[model samples]
Target: MNRLTTACLLTPALLAAPACALDPQPVNIQGLQFYPSLLLGERYDDNYREAAYAAPSSWITTLEPRLRLVAEDRNSAYRLTYAGAQQTYHDDSSASHLDHRLLLEGILEFTARHRLTLKAGYSRLEETASTAIPGVNDEYSLRTFGATYRFGAETARNNLEFAANHERLRFHDDSLVNAREERDASRLGVTWFHRIGGTRALIETRYEDFDYVQPDSPLNSHNLALLTGAVWEASAKTSGRIRAGYQRKEYDDDGRDGLESPMWEIGLDWEPRSYSRFSLTTRQAYDEGDDGADAIKQTRTRLDWRHEWSERLSSTLFVGAARLRYQGLDREDDLSSAGLTLTYQPRRWLELALGYSHWDNDSTVDRERFQRNLYTLTATGSL
Candidate 1:
C-alpha cells in the first residue's frame, strides 16, 4: 500500500492509546488529539518561455494530516506528534510529480525546579519533478533529526531553552545516473527570558554549520553562522525584537576561497485590542557563493493583520515583499504578494476557511505573476 493508505489505517490505533488511559478517571482523555487540515486551491501564472520550468495551471488539491498527543502524570510526561502532507501538481502540462513531507516528534517532560523537557524529532521530505526526456523524472529527498531541551519557571523571573538540530539531504534522479551528494546542517540555539518590574525581556543566540560533500565532483564546503537577538515587551500592546548575525564560508571546490557575510532582522508584534493583532517584520541577509562566484544580498519585509468580527466570522490580511540583488551578474529581482483569509467557526469542533493570494515578480531577467484562490470546508467531531 501507499503512504496515504498506511496513515489512514494507523489513525485508529493512535487514538485509542492515549496517555490518560492509565488513570482511573481517564483524566478527560486530554493527552492525544488528531486533527487534519485539508487544503484545496487553484493557481494560475502567466509567462513561461522555458520548457524546463514547471508552470502551474488553475486547479489543485492538497491533503495534510496533523496529530498531537500529550501524556502526563504527577512527576513525568511524554508526548508524540506527527504530520504528513502531500501536494500533486496538476500543472499546465499534467506531466509533473508530487511533493510529500513527513514529520515526527517525541518529547519527555521531567518534574524539576526549572521544569526541564527533552525532545527528539525526525522529518523527511521528498519531491518528484519532470525531466527533459518524457517519462523520466527527477527525485530529491531530505532527512533530518534534532533534539531540544526547554526549561521554564512557574512564578520566578527566569526561563531557559536550548536546542540542537542536524539535517541531511540526499538527491537522486533517473535523469542523472551518478548524481548523488550529501548535505549536512547543524544548528544550536539558546534563549533566556527574564522578568523585571513587570517588564519582560528575552535574549537569544544561535550558531549553525552547513557542510556539503560530493565524491563525484570532488567538492567539499562548509558554512558557519552566528546570530544574536533580543526582545523586549514595553507594554501590553507593543513588543519588538532585533537580531544581527555573521557567516563565514569555506570551500575546497575548484579553487574557491573563503568568504564572510552579515545579516540583520527587525520584527514587531502588537495587539491593538482583544480582537485585533498586527505584526511587521523585515530582514536583510547576505550569502557567500561557492566555486568563486559572487555573493548574493536579499531583503524581505512583511505586514500581517488579523481581525475578529464576531463569533462565527473572522478575517485576516497579510502583505509580503522581497527584493534580491546579485553581485557580478548585475541582476535585480523583486516580489510583492498579498493574502486574505476568512474563517468561520460556528461550533467548537467545526471550522471553514476561505483564502485568496496574489503574487507578482519583477526582475531584469524575467517577469512573472500568479494568483491563487482556495476554499476549504472542514468538519471535525469526536467522542
Candidate 2:
C-alpha cells in the first residue's frame, strides 16, 4: 500500500486497540495546581514558503512541552501557562528554531456583581518569508496586555463592560523586514447589553490607535467603530451572535487616503444531535499590512463540522474563504482552504491526531498565486 493509505489504516487500527493505562494526574503545590503535557509531531508541507512557483517541500519534526498553573478562590482566579517548541527540518536545517510563549490571566470579583478580567501574554516565533517582507525567514516577538471590567448584577437584565488592550510587535532581524513595520497598538472600548426574552441586545463603541516605531511611516493610523449586535440562545441546540457596524480610519500621512468601510461579524453554533456539532463564522475588518500599504480590508467566512465516530474517536472538517483588498493599492487576493482532522483519545491523558489541509490562492498579481498541501500526525500525553 502507498504511504498515505498505510498511514490512514494504521491510525484507526492503533486507536481501536484496548484501553491503556491512565496517565499521571495533575500535581498540586499548596494552593497552586500544575498540569504538564508533551507533544510529538511530524508534518509534511508541500509548499513551505508558499511560493507561487518552484515551491520547496520539507519534512518537519516538532517537540513541544507545556505547563499550566492555576489557583482559584471563592471570588478570584489566576492562571499561568508556558509552552515551548523546538522544530527540526530534514532538508532545511537553517529553518529550524525554537519558539516560546507565556501567558498570564486572572479574574477578580470585587463585589457581588462587579468583576474584572486581566490577561497578559508574550510570544517569540518565526514565520515563513512569504508572510513577511524581504522573502526570508522572519523572527518576531509579540507582547499583549488586556483588561476588562463588568458592572451590574448577574441576575439583572442590563449590564455594562469596559475594556482596554495594548499590543507591541518587534522583529528580531530588521533587515529582513522594515523596522517601520514594528508597531504598538492600543484599543479602548465599552459595551452595554440588555436582555430581551431569550436574546441579549448589545451596543458597543471602540477607539484604536496605531503607532509605528519609525517616524516616517505612513501606516500609522487611528480607527473608530460603532456597532450594534444581538446574541441569541434560541434553544439548547442553537446559539449565535451577529453584529454590524461602520469603521473609519484616519492616517497620519497626507499623501495616502484613509478608508471608511462597513464592518460586520457573525458566529453561530448548532448541535442538532448529541454527537454532532456545527459552527459558522464570518467577519469583515481591516488588517495591518507589511507591504508598505496602509491596510488590507479583508472579509472571511468559515464553516466547521465535528462528529463523534465512536467513544474514543472524533473527526472535524472545516472550509474557509477570504478576500483581501489592499487599501492604497490595486491589489486583491482571494484565498480558500479546506481541512480535515481525526482525533482519538482512548485514555484520559493520551491523544492522537491526524490531519490534512489544502490551501489555494488566486491574486490579481501573478506572483502571489499558489496552491499548497499539508499532512500532519501528532501524539500528545499529559501528566
RMSD of 2: 7.3
Best by TM-score: 2
Question: Model 2: residues >4 Å from true position, as ranges?
Answer: 1-24, 129-135
Tens digits of per-residue lDDT, candidate 1, 347-379, equal 554455677776666666542232333343333
Q: Per-model C-alpha lDDT, please?
A: 0.54, 0.81
Best by lDDT: 2
TM-scores for the candidates: 0.70, 0.92
Quick one: RMSD of model 1?
A: 7.7
In angstroms, give how far residue 284 of model 1 lies from its true place. Answer: 3.0
